[model samples]
Target: MMDSNDTPVDVRLSLRVNGQMRQLDVPPNVVLLDALRDRLGLTGTKKGCDHGQCGACTVLVNGEAINSCLALAVVHDGDDITTVEGLAGEADLSPLQAAFLEHDAYQCGYCTPGQLMSATELLSNRKVGTTDAEVAEAMSGNICRCGAYKNILSAIQETRQQHAGAAID
Candidate 1:
């Protein structure tokens, strides 16, 4: 859309990001990943494989994990979004974050944010199986170029065990 002066108009969006209400005026075509990183300064969500093949841009939208690179910012107005930055509390890291650290789940750390976000959703989902194979299959979308899949899987399993009966928010 253009104004009378032929200048592109940015769409206003209100989103509850990481428990904070954030407002941004971005181009209608701006993907959620760009909006979060470039506009809101939340660079934890990486821009790898912008085509959405790699899950490096994964983020929680309305409590579900999605590839932010595939979602338009304007369409998610009022949606609750969670990036890797929001995984921790005021003074402590979240269980999954701690698990990742304890298990050394990352090598280069480029894909760690996406891994954690995907694991977060997986843990909360009771439909996914508890076996390592199931977990691995569920997380196949997020590729670890450094070949840290074993450690990543360990961290996810450990965290899943810890929150066995509890519902992860």
Candidate 2:
């Protein structure tokens, strides 16, 4: 079984993402965001500040949010990753996306992806309820310079109402 001709020059890393497992040969220096956006063509994860200050590069790793910009592509092999594009199928949008739109939660929308990621996680956690203050505190990690906090909080609160049977998300 030893064939010198088949010896690969680089190792292929496997990535399990959005319920699919894929592999890629990436250099050690490449960041996860670039690998996902550039190589893999998963462009939902945006690049904002790039220094971890702006949470625009947020993605979910096994249901927990992580800054894609700071993660190394070569290191997270076999990990389950969820980007903004992974949230829904085809034309349908996730409830958070609909909620954000209904409340006009974004201005330029540069920070919308990260905001949605944080909001999605916070909303799912029973500990973080629908109160304006709670929503505000939970979303503090993702900065929206557009000052859309009020609307964002309203949207979260409104989404919560849907869960409680108001039937308007």
Separate clash counts for every candidate: 0, 0
Best by lDDT: 1
C-alpha lDDT of candidate 1 relative to the true structure: 0.94
Ten consecutive residues with minimal summed lDDT in candidate 1? 160-169
Give the poorly placed runs of model 2, Cα more than 4 Å off. 1-11, 161-169
> Cα-based RMSD of the predictions, in order?
1.9, 4.6
* Model 1: per-residue Cα lDDT at residue 76: 99
Estimated TM-score for each candidate: 0.94, 0.83
Q: How much is 45 displaced in model 2, in angstroms?
A: 1.0
Best by TM-score: 1
Tell me the tens digit of each residue's lDDT in model 1 across 75-144.
9999999999999999999999999999999999999999999999998888999999999999999989
Error of 2 at 84 (Å): 0.8
Residue 96, model 2, lDDT: 78
